[model samples]
Target: MTLIDALIQYGLFMAKTLTLVLAIGLLLIVVLRARPGGSGDDDDDGSRLEVVDLNGRYANMADTIKAATLPPKMVKKAFKAERKAEKARAKAEAADKRRLFVIDFHGDLMASEVGALREVISALLIAATPEDEVLLRLDNAGGAVHEHGLAASQLLRLRSAGIPLTIAVDKVAASGGYLMACVANRLLAAPFAVVGSIGVLAEMPNFHRLLQEKGVDFELHTAGEHKRTLTLFGENTDEGRAKLREQLEETHAQFKAFIAAYRPTLDLSKVATGEYWHGEQALSLGLVDAVQTSDDYLLAARAEADLYKVRYRARKRLLQRLLGADGARALARPLARPIGSVARWLRNLGGARCA
Candidate 1:
């Protein structure tokens, strides 16, 4: 073969090999991402709960900045004055000093952070006293009913222990997120945070029409009449749609009831309309107790209480440590598109006849 033709052949071979490798790699990444405790907990080898002194951290930050701008004499004077004040405050409050335990739950659509939250809550249940309080820095836009429901139930454990649970939302606590937030004894939200989407949603795309046009046969079998409703592959009927709607309505009612049980003073009729409101509006509607960000709350608490941020950390595998979950997803998208294109090209090339 001519050099040009040989080069083309070699390029095609490399392309095929690369496509196969990427396809396998993408599959492995998906499996790893889906595995439970991908964030470090499920692994048997390396996991621990991390407790950080927020009070000390805040002081250090202030001191560092003060030292940067102030002259050496003023810096020393400031440090000495702060030390005197700290000793006096520590002496007076030594007998009744309260602890504020902070936990962060940055949830995804699956409420996967629930695992780490579980560890934190368990630790608090053992160590926290009735005088102490929990401030959950929660940021979630809502997600699966069952997942967020479990997360809510976990928060309820603290309330059951009379530990005074408080949840602070800086960005959003809607739908399933609201479900978890309502479990708190006091819920705080930032002025622009989204809150209160007390509604149920169920939806799926049906491909029966496309299959019919392509002369493809699809069959579904179920023993019970309501076993499957509003499916993805099969044709949907009015009866199935109606049943799904009924289920959604039932879930919405339960959600409202759950919120009412926690915040008995809320007017469910006005706020449970499947619409979210900003934090200020939520405060007016009684969806949140106050319009304050978590940072503000923590800063204020730092004056009278010792603040500690608790977290669960697990040792990560080499691959997990390198790419992490988000990185793996970012890598997967580029890999998946090229794999599909290469697959189609290979199929088309194979179909072409030679003379």
Candidate 2:
């Protein structure tokens, strides 16, 4: 072969080697950029929970970007601006159409965290116009008497304002839960969601037998005969038992009468039997009006008027904030505190078993 030909072949070999190396480097870079579970990346948007301002402030669709899921620190930021924009947009759009406010009530029915609920309801009552509707997404299995009763009273606030209230139950709304549902002008439920247990129950244990075996006598003193009918430590007389039973019967009667007043059309004799029915069966029994889920209801009504979900932001307790201090000390000794917590939990378990 000629020397010039050999030189040309050497040049071609070098060019091929350089191109292969560059291609491999580009592949590695692409793989590194596609890593999973990134913070604030485009790929992570769908998996992240969004903090939506239902009140109407950030109307610009682009402004509602994938913000970081709300941490305690971020939640402290005022959502007032976003809420204002949303409200303006809603008001403008609702000028020609009817609107509805859909609210949810789930989990244990108690007045412990009721302050937040009252605030949300008060806001809705003030913002709602005469043409707007109020829909409650109620799902409660019932709890303490006075607490549930107060929760039910909050629903009446909307009614008293002359706003139409509709209740949609996706799951169980029994006992005190039904007390709230019955207040709505119309009630809808899913096919299998438990409904109606219009009754009250109270149960307590009497340790009289155990105390007698241990030779421990307990004394009782009361001003009235009914004040201390069923005692936990003292023997219960027939008169005391009779009195307790009478009290329960009276409460049950009052519950039935209350339901009758709200729903005069319901057959009081059959529904007051303390039995629950599913959605279709409940419709036949007059417990609910129709079968529908909250999602379908919202989607169907979206084109008619602006839809807003009402919920109260839960405040963190002082103790939790104190323990979760934001400082170098917290980061330095995080494991120490976590280990101590586990140890205390184990100690409590052992003590409970021994007792």
Candidate 3:
């Protein structure tokens, strides 16, 4: 085919894709409008822990362990004693078994999974026993400071409850991701997983010179001196730059403290130098405790306990479901005044009806 024909075909395909996406989006909006807040579960009891037995699927595997696969050779002499102790055996077996609860947190720039993590931890706290353990599968390249900080605190909830928490980093856990990983009692990572980027970063595009050339005035008012430091359109001064650096340093210090509180063996001064190490390197530097995939850990623990993958699937707001995260936020500011506007309109309509 000629170059022009190929280009035309590609353009047609993209247009078709866009059209399909728009159709789906509109269909979703119609569905949401038909049933708003009708999914039920407006109470705390709505969120529940879902448990799955891991051994059921892989029971025949070579590595599988069964406590009583072979029965003791029963003779007529011992048959009477065994019959009498049958109920006692059942009670003893029930007391010996423990549970393993699993959760997954895939973080982005905003660390949105923290909300669900909080709910999952709260639910588990009520149902989990002291012998039971929690495993978190974490995957992120790190993002915002406060966002990941809060996400880390959610993991700390498991620790505060004295529940054994293990973090599995299959791909990457750097910066804010590492912050949350450190809160776990044990950290597992893939052999080549990127881990341990303990640092701070701030980047902003400055259009001050362009504004100057265009003779545009951008005035920023603030209550504090360092409140309006580095900005997009404003001319940055040395004092503002220094203050920004100071704030970054302070945040970094807090990050270090958080890591230290959990994993006291690590020397943060060395590994927290703003560079990420791979899983094996991280183990040598005391960043991660072991090199293992999430699958490997789960499969190995299957024989010991009843493993359950827990999740808190929160119902999204009507607007959010229709427009998604970014589009919802983009339209949120304008929609904030709707309640007052509707109330005022109803009052005026009532007055007119009375007249």
Candidate 4:
């Protein structure tokens, strides 16, 4: 062949080789992604070690892949075997008739977390029988009022379904957190878990003075007189401050009333003073029924009933998973905000809706 033709042929061969290598790499990624349960070993001793390496942002792709890779027939057989074993085990442990469902709430109250909590509550409702007891392992300092209220309302589903609900607070269940715990038939808390704060607050900084000092004029308009209160740039008024205070007081009263309604045993006269207490103190104050951590309760209950730690599988759509992983701020813009402000608003909205 001519030197020019030979060079072109070599270049084509190299390109083909690169393409093949790229194809193989893509195939491997696909295979890894497909095996969702993660890499693990099933030993001859009937023990399996499943490795779930989740990046903690998206749905656990590793678990999905593993579950997907298993054949439907085999999965069915395995499920049947597990059920049979469970039945036999339950019979053997007849003395322990109480089944325990542990519902854990450990993070900030966000929309995604709320969604997951809702799913968990729903699953627990379905799985729990009349005799089975539902235990919520709650640990939240506080968060957006509405979000936490919704979370608490999800717990109420257990009550509506006639399943007994017990809230076990280990760290804290203040403000909206308490809103959820109040619904439980029994409220248990660890020694130092912060337990109460029955009030509402809203704040905004006014740059009106700064702007005026710099010889800058600010103007704002609203369709409704009360649409925007305590503005950032607008002038303040005695009437406006009074109105805001009145609104807050009304919300606080409603919060107090809600607690009273759910936990009639509590002394609203004392506990509604916008103060928090430790777990033992809270029990005396009637904020909690007993002092117990979820771990202790779970360990004790494992002897008799089947222990299931229930949480919803966070099933994110493909786009969200990709965007969340890409550090795409714009994708999360709708969900992002000052954490405190969001929590306050969530609580306020939730209270208003419930009221």
Give RMSD to native, each candidate: 8.7, 22.8, 12.7, 15.8
| Prediction 4 global C-alpha lDDT | 0.70
Q: Candidate 1: where is the Cα deviation over 4 Å?
A: 1-23, 26-44, 321-355
Assess every candidate by TM-score: 0.83, 0.65, 0.70, 0.66
Arrange candidates, best TM-score first: 1, 3, 4, 2
Q: Candidate 3, residue 126: CA error in Å?
A: 0.5
Candidate 3, 153-257: lDDT as tens digits:
887877888899999999988888898899999999999999987888776668899999999999887898766677768888898888877877888888889
Error of 4 at 54 (Å): 20
Candidate 1 has what TM-score? Answer: 0.83
Top candidate when judged by lDDT against the true structure = 1
Write down the lDDT of every candidate, Cα atoms only: 0.84, 0.70, 0.77, 0.70
Error of 3 at 57 (Å): 4.2
| Model 3 lDDT, full chain set | 0.77
How do the residues 37-106 of candidate 4 rate in per-residue lDDT, one tens digit apiece? Answer: 5453322322222222112212244335645888988767766775697679768777756676666677
Tens-digit per-residue lDDT, 1-355, candidate 1: 9999999999999999988987787777666556455563364656789999999999999999999999999999999999999999999998999999999998766688898888889989999999999999988887677788889999999999999999999998888889999999999999999998788775445789999999998999999999877667788899988887787777788888898999999999998888899988999999999999999999999999999999998656445667986785576666666765666444332121100
